[model samples]
Target: MRTFTVEIEKDEKFYIAQCVEHSNCFTQGKTIEEAIHNIKEVIDLILHIKRPKLHIILKDSLVNAL
Candidate 1:
């Protein structure tokens, strides 16, 4: 398992989350909760498809695997 930092921002109609470790990976939803769920799904898909290329960070700590 790998841990990555996810930054979430709220917009006018949606919440967006960007995974710091993965480029071109972002998730958006109607609500903050939905955005979090969507991001989790996106991260899982990314990890499955992209494997590993960048360093993962968690809570200001560098992580190899979650």
Candidate 2:
């Protein structure tokens, strides 16, 4: 499993979320909670598109995969 850092900032009418590890990856939403959720989707999409061959076991992220 891979771990990445995310940063969130408030800008006008939305909360902007950005991946610290990926400068071009970012998303915004109406609320902080929505921003967090939207950022996850953006990150997931970026990972899938950029690392198509990457493999991960969802259930064993830290305890077992570490």
lDDT top scorer = 1
Where does model 2 exceed 4 Å of error?
Answer: 49-66
Q: 1-66, model 1: which lDDT tens digit per residue? A: 566677766566776778887767788888656866777778768677333232322332212222
Give all TM-scores, in the order shown: 0.66, 0.67
Please give, for residues 1-66, the per-residue lDDT of candidate 2 as tens digits: 466666666665776777777888788889666876776777778775432222222222222423
The residue pairs found clashing in candidate 1 are 1-66
Question: Candidate 2, after superposition: displacement of residue 39 in Å?
Answer: 0.8
Report the lDDT of model 2 for residue 36. Answer: 68
Cα error, candidate 1, residue 43 (Å): 1.2
Provide C-alpha RMSD values for all models, in order.
8.2, 9.8
